[model samples]
Target: MIRDLEDEILGCTRCSRLIDYIRKVAIEKKPKYRNYQYWGKPLPGFGDPNAWLLIVGLAPAAHGGNRTGRVFTGDMSGERVYRALYEIGLSSSPKSESRYDLVELKGVYLTNAVKCAPPKNKPNKEEIGSCSYFLKKEIESLPKLKVILTLGRIAFDTTTNILGIDGKFSHMAIYSTNRLTVVASYHPSQQNFVSGRLTWGNWISIFYKIKTLYTSHNA
Candidate 1:
């Protein structure tokens, strides 16, 4: 079922603007990674089928995920995210350079609110609404999912809307309901890192707290 869902997501063209942008990005190519072929297609969820933790981000990076075909891969944000996951022994590697790389995530699933990369890293309201269907379907498919970790305000807002939950976006904020717990965090984007808003010490701390919550839920 997951594989079928992924295939459907890859073929989606719900948002023409996003579809065109990804195609243009694929053809133009980043100067440094010019030799490589870009994925350019809509990204789907990536991780264990029975994952207990769901990590949601705003969207794929044009040069990172759009190029490598994996959310959070081939980007600076991915570096910090994986590094922190590795610190907590949840990731096989500290870097997510490629989807085909042996960087496995244990007990966690990774996905984005918007499957396609939008220009300037921002997706308009219509685009977000169109992608919400896929997000909802993906979440429903995960039977064991117990918690959602949303990175960035957009992701938090999207998740809340899709799940019909009342919440606010704030770094390290936790919200709970009869369904799943939601933990909000600042995105591990370049701006957050450069501004010292999300340092390694604090970034990894988020995972540690999640680990405890995850274990408790499992128990």
Candidate 2:
């Protein structure tokens, strides 16, 4: 049933603007990927169905996830995340080059606030709201979900709204109750990493904290 829902997410075109934008990008292939085929549709969340940890990102990178057909795949941000998860014993690989890269998660699930890649990496409020329904269904499908790690303020805010939690956003900010823990972390965008807003040390520290808290919660 969960798999069926994921397929439904992949086919969703509820947001016409998003659909048009994605199609435009698909046609205007990047020079390096001129010969490659793009997925060009809504990306369904990836990882273990019985996951305890849910990592919510802002959205698909126009060229990365949009091209590779996998959330957090074939991108710098993905490199940072998979490496961190690998170090923490949650990921099978430190690199997510493509959807067929054999990358796997042990107890982790990865997804985005918005399923489709929006123009300039920004989705308006209505687009976000339209996509939230899919997110809500995905969250509810994970019966074992105990922790949600939201990357960036957009992801944090969207997740909180879906879960009906009025929580503030800040790096390392944590909201605990309702049988789940929601932790906010800075997004690993190139800008954030290049500007040192989200450093390797800090990113790793957040995952370590998650491991500790999750262990204690489920112990």
Candidate 3:
């Protein structure tokens, strides 16, 4: 079931604008990544299949996930994510630089609101609505999912809308759906990290809270 959904997600071409943008970015190549061959396609969510926790982000970064072929890989946001997970004993590595890396998530699944990278790091309402179908399917496929951690306001809003819930996004806020506990946090974007909006201490603490929530639920 999961594999089928993943295949469909990978081959998705629902958004013409996004597909064209990723391909264009891939070919043009950033000065820093000129020699690198970008993945330049839709990304699939991945991690422990049996996870009770699901972490959601906005979408793939143009040069990050879109290039590396793994969500949150090859970016500053990814660095904080994997480092926090590793410190919490949920990931095998403190960093995820490539899709080939030995990074393994123990009890979490990671995905995004949109599977493909969008221009200016923002996907419009129509695109987000269309992509949420795949995201919803993923949530249904995770039998053990009891908690969802949404990074940033966009991610938080998308997830809640998918689950048919109504809640405003707030950093470190917690909400509950009929079948899942939802937590929202500030995205670990470069600005958030550099501007002191999302500190390392708070970032790590979010994971710790998730760790505690799932542990208690399982207990």
Q: What's the C-alpha lDDT at position 29 in model 3?
A: 80
> What's the CA error at residue 117 for candidate 2, in Å?
0.1
Give the TM-scores of the predictions, in the order they appear. 0.97, 0.97, 0.97
Weakest lDDT window of 10 consecutive positions for candidate 3: 210-219
Report the Cα lDDT for candidate 3.
0.91
Q: Per-residue CA lDDT of candidate 1, range 1-219, in tens? A: 667889999989989999999999999998999998999999997887888889999999999999998878989987888888888887888888887888888878899999999999999999998998988888898888999999999999999888888888999999987868999999999899899998888988999999889888878
Candidate-wise lDDT, in order: 0.90, 0.91, 0.91
State the lDDT of candidate 2 residue by residue for 67-129, as single tens digits. Answer: 999989978998899999999999988888888778889999999999999999999999999
- Which residues of candidate 3, in runs, are more than 4 Å off? none
**Which is the better candidate, 1 or 3, if ranked by lDDT?**
3
lDDT of 3 by residue, 126-185 (tens): 999999999899899998899999999988998898888889999988988768999999
Q: Which residue ranges in model 1 land beyond 4 Å of their true spot?
A: none
Q: Supply every candidate's count of residue pairs whose N, Cα or C atoms clash at under 3 angstroms.
A: 0, 0, 0
* Candidate 1 residue 164 C-alpha distance from true site, Å: 1.4
- Candidate 1 global lDDT: 0.90
